[model samples]
Target: MKKPLVLIVDDEPDICELLEITLNRMDIQTYTAENIRTAKALLQQKHFELCLTDMKLPDGNGLDLIDTIQASPNPIPVAVITAHGNMDTAILAMKKGAFDFISKPVDLAVLRQLINSALKLSDPVVTKERRIRHELLGESLSMWEIRSKIDKVARSQAPVLISGESGSGKELVARLIHQQSSRSDHSFVAINCGAIPLELMESEFFGHKRGSFTGAVTEKKGLFQAAEGGTLFLDEVADLPLPLQVKLLRAIQEKKIRPIGEHQEIPVDIRLLSATHRNLAEMVQTGSFRQDLFYRINVIDLHIPPLRDRKADIPALTEHILVKLSAVNKIRPPALSKTALAALQQYHFPGNVRELENILERALALYDGKIIEYDDLNLPISTHNKLNCPEYAPDFGSLEDYLEKIERKAIILALKENKRDKAAAAKQLGLSVRSFSYRLKKLNLDS
Candidate 1:
């Protein structure tokens, strides 16, 4: 088998010698260049699997070399070595199409990991795309564009901030990116940032050594350690506390973490992916979120459009949901009546794809024979009372179950009307604040 070829571009002879020695020890071939002019010549002359260039070059900068490589017909993966403590340059290089970036006074371990990941993109077997379209579940132009964007961004090490409404499959999108990336073989660790206790946030993220604190009877690895050489997805990242956000920004910027009770900082090799339904820009303006942290995580924003905008895909989405529900219920997949399909498309989906699934699953249970009608959907009524039709009454489901559905829809409607203000929504519904909060938890709408 032919060894992988790497192009090492740097003006310093000592740095070039070090990189050449490192690659040679790893059973890889290396071609050296002193500056951008020499690197471009080498790039045109040889087919290299990966290229590593210092940020500073006597003739030109690394960004120039990156641009030249990307403009070529067949662009191999490129990485930039930035000066220590200069995260802005690293981020800029990554945005300019560098596959990854490593800090100067380089850590050889991290460099090895970065090179391996870049090389994986050149390996046909490891680089094959993971078919994840079925999980996305829409055929609109927006969905198509999202799929294309995912393909492009999966090749980079930049932090991707997935923006979408609740239940719009933000985590699913993150998982897809991880699965299709060079880090696919490693773990894809996901955690809801809002779900963790405030006191334990630091320990949960950076881990703690034995006897680190009251609960530190045993040493535990944090999400970063667990997701080493893979991806760590922080869902609902906007909910993080201000203090934790500062620590998080440092970890991401430095690519190193100091677990609680540990004296030395440890180098961590992992990709960061975050998501939120909230408007982070607004949060930043209000001083609720750290601006530096926001910039670090939101290198690239991928927005998944809500279902209402893609109503044309409703019929197909409903069919897909019904099939899954049928399999779980041990029943044949039911067909939706034409009227039912139209009713779904006409209604606005505040909870996005998640609500659609819930409505369909509930309808499938009470629906008789194989066809689900409009009434079975139990869609929330509008201010004008659209369900006033005499035929809208269906008596198949029990009173208890029917009432629960009514309660869920009524609460959803109230929340939507009041802009999700629990206090105002409770007053509008003639319920106490505590009761409203309870109802939200009971209806599984608190998230």
Candidate 2:
């Protein structure tokens, strides 16, 4: 069998000689180049499985080489050799489509690992068929751009910061990236950083030794250890307290972690992906968040557009949600009338997709007819007022009876919208908790 070939590009002769000897020892063939001009000449001559280039070359920087390689019809996997502690340049190279990066005075173990990963990318077995495609489910221009970026970033090991409002599916974007990456076969551990208690955050993130502290009855694996050789998605990462941020930065940069009560540090291989609805830049300016950690994690940003921006996709999203709701309830999925969909599209969804799903679930359960009309949807009165009928429609019978019916309908709508939480519904309707409870009983809606 022919040996796998690699191109080593660097201005220093010592670095080139070192890399050539290492590759030869690993049964790989190497073609060496001293400058960008020679590297381009060698690249033009024949195919190579991988290209390792230094960031500061005599002719040009590593970014220029990355662009040249990425623009080719069949781009080979490339890694950058950056000077130690210069993560900004490393991040720029990764953004420009470098497969991965290593720092100067490279450890042989790390170099071998990087080379092995790049070789896997060049393998024919790791083809498009192997990629697991998850549905993002939208056809808007912004959605198209998001999908394109996801595909591009999935091929790299760069840390991605997903920014969007709550319920906009930032974690879903992270999952899609992991599923489509070379790390798909491993665990994708996701944790909401804010959800963990402040007292136990360290143990939760870095694991704990048995009997290390109170309530430590058994040894526990932290999220980092659990996601070994895979992805760790820190949802709501902005909520991480300042103290833990420093430790997290070290673990990420060094690729090592020391669990609570442990004397030795364990090397962990994890692809870090994080998300936040809060503004990190603002938080950094205010000293509430670590600026260094912010820069480290925000190497690339993926923005998820709010649901209101993609109103054109509401019909399809509504249909998909209805189908799932119907399957769970064992009923035929109801279709949305044009007016009802228009109401949904017009109402600014403060809660984004999550709010849309809740609205559909409530409608699916409560509406009796197969076609959901405008009146059937329990949207805010502002939307319902456009084509409202219950108010203006005349009643020939007792006036008191009509008024009672209207009040009953309004109260019932509030309860459903608030998920049967009487207190919240009362607040929405400008009533005290006691008054709301009395009204629910009076209308016989408490049943």
Candidate 3:
């Protein structure tokens, strides 16, 4: 068998010699290039399993090399070397498609681990396993961008913080990330940080001994222990109280957790993925959330756009929801009339995907026909008023077009009246959450 080859690109002779020596000891053949110009030439002549380059080079930076490689028909996995403590540059490199990064004055242990991970990409089995397709269920441009980011971020061990409105499926995004990562074989424990009681937060997170408390009849494993060698998703992480924040920070930084009433701390290995709809930066400014903890968890941030923002996906989402609802209920799924769909496309959905499901479930229960009509929808009076308003009239192509214009105006007015709160606007408009969401998309009124 031919030995796996690695390409090393660095301007510094000492660094090149050091990496070559280290890799050679591992029986990995290496080709060295003192600049990007030489590295490009070597890449054209060789088939390397991996490439490691320094961010700063005499001819060009690592980013330039990454771009050149990525533009090629088949690009090799590449890692970059950044200056010590240059987290911003490292993150930029990752976003630009670098496999991973090592800081200058790098530890050989970390370097070896990075190389091994990059080489794993060459294995067809590992590549297939790491590309777990996420069930995000949207074709909007925003969703496509998110999927791309997920694929890239899954390859790294960095902490990721997902931000979006309530019911936007942040947990689903986290699960997809876990599935696509190297930790796919391990457990994925999700915890609702807000649901746990203040007194029991620590115990729930770090577990407890049998005799630790009055109700402790058996030893319990906390989320950290339960999620050992896996991913721990803390949903609504901003809800954690100040005291628990300190403990959480310690565990994250030290990679050790001490259960309640336990003297010894247990070492834990976990990839932390946290999410919240609330503005954490604002919370930090107001002294509600810990800044240090915020910085720690938000190493690579991803924001999911609200359903209202991606109104273009309403039809597809509705179809998916209807299919799932029909399968579970063991009933023939009803087809939505154009008017019914228009009603949904025009209304603003404040509750997002959850509200959409709620509206559909309610409609399914009330209507007993193969086709769901506009009247059968039982939409709010606000939507009707939009069509019947005696205000200034515009030149209409048809009655349907006029009603649509009216609905657009009414939804926009309701959104403004309610300070853009989808739930409140939906309630005030007398439309179901799903109807409001659908209408928002139908009329292009969602912001």
Candidate 4:
């Protein structure tokens, strides 16, 4: 809803006025500065979507401004205006963080195009900040680890495989990766492998020529092609069919794709990042997933632990989610009663972080600005007793008795839920399979 602001900096008043008029005609708000000092002052005081400055300023070189801008918290996309035959300076400008360089006799059309592109780059950062303010609001160790991984991974072009339970913030992680990557200047394409029908998978991945299929009334670019220099996040990647997996493997290996009905393979420079809730190793063992393809994508594995494993982060996560929901709904954030907080801390989030967000959102809507009490949480009452397990609660009985009861309950629940699959239950319980067998032996439940 806000028009982009463009700052035009030139030593010559006429040049600044001309560009201001042009930008104003395009419905972009303009700010004019006649020197580097004034430009820097304006930049510090206000946020401009894009900046156009002369390569040579009265007090300092435009290159100096580029360095200063790049060091700022939110740097504006900069374009250097240089004299004709100053190609060397132009190159240097770009190297110093200038988005583009324009010649002295500026062609208004070219200048407009460059400004337009620079403004477009600002959109992603703006959109990302808003989304973070809305969706991401936690500082838990698990959340912090994820943020740290995103920051580190964004600097490289490696293929990342994010494995987490459903509703565990996979998409948010993908977005952060894209936002922090070198290819942040390009588009980020995301697709859910499980949501697309098998018959349309090829068309969706490689796009299609007009008239190639029944619904192909026009030529379309596939997700891979659209994300050419950026990232392609394949959500629910385990759902990709076996046949498509082969094609995808080849594409990743060769760095190209052959669109449906096309002869020549189009070269693509995509950074692939895939996520799935399913156990990939188990899938591979069962022949449901390609082992080679798994190796290709699992170059850098980032496992987002389930929320239950990171219960220490619940308070921060709860507050963050509540604030975000309030901002989105245009209402004041509701208060969480101590009883409600205690109840939430006790529950094992089977759905993980996503379930926690949903629960908070539901509570906000249900309570409608009122204080959220324990009853308002609507979690299983049994969860409260589970929280009172001796690990967190003060011991009232012999240590041996507490340990036996906790172990018995955990084993029974794991066995029942895993349908007596001891190995699988062991993994869920974070125990070695052999140790689980010994536990069954000790409990006399081996039969």
Instruction: Give per-model TM-scores.
Output: 0.84, 0.82, 0.70, 0.57
Off by more than 4 A, model 2: 1-3, 21-27, 210-218, 381-447
Better of 1 and 2 by lDDT: 1
Return the TM-score for candidate 1, rounded to 2 decimals.
0.84
Best by lDDT: 1
Tens digits of lDDT, candidate 3, 197-297: 99989889999998899988889899998998679999999999999999998887656789988999887767789999999999999999999889878
Worst 10 residues of 1 by lDDT: 387-396
Query: Which of the predicted structures, 1 or 3, would earn the higher lDDT when compared with the native?
Result: 1
lDDT of each: 0.87, 0.84, 0.83, 0.78
Q: What lDDT is reached at residue 184 by model 3?
A: 72
Model 4, which residues run further than 4 Å from truth?
A: 1-137, 213-215, 368-370, 381-447
- Per-residue lDDT tens digits for candidate 4, residues 1-447, read 788898888989888888988899989999988888998899988889888899788898989988998898777678888897565676566656576667767767657656665665567655464333324446567777777767656544557899988777788888888876656668889999999999999999999899987889999889998997778999999999999999998887556699998888886767788999999989999999999888768767788887777777789889878888999999888888765786677787778777888888888867845898654676642553642333423332567765775687688778887999999999999999999999999988788
Candidate achieving the largest TM-score: 1
The lDDT of model 3 is 0.83
Q: What's the ranking of the predictions by lDDT, best on top? A: 1, 2, 3, 4
TM-score attained by model 3: 0.70
Return whichever of 2 and 3 wins on lDDT: 2
Candidate 3, residue 192: the lDDT equals: 94
lDDT of 2 by residue, 239-328 (tens): 999999999999877777999989988877788999999989999999999999998899889999888888876787888888888899
Off by over 4 Å in 3: 1-3, 7-44, 52-92, 101-116, 129-134, 198-229, 243-269, 375-447
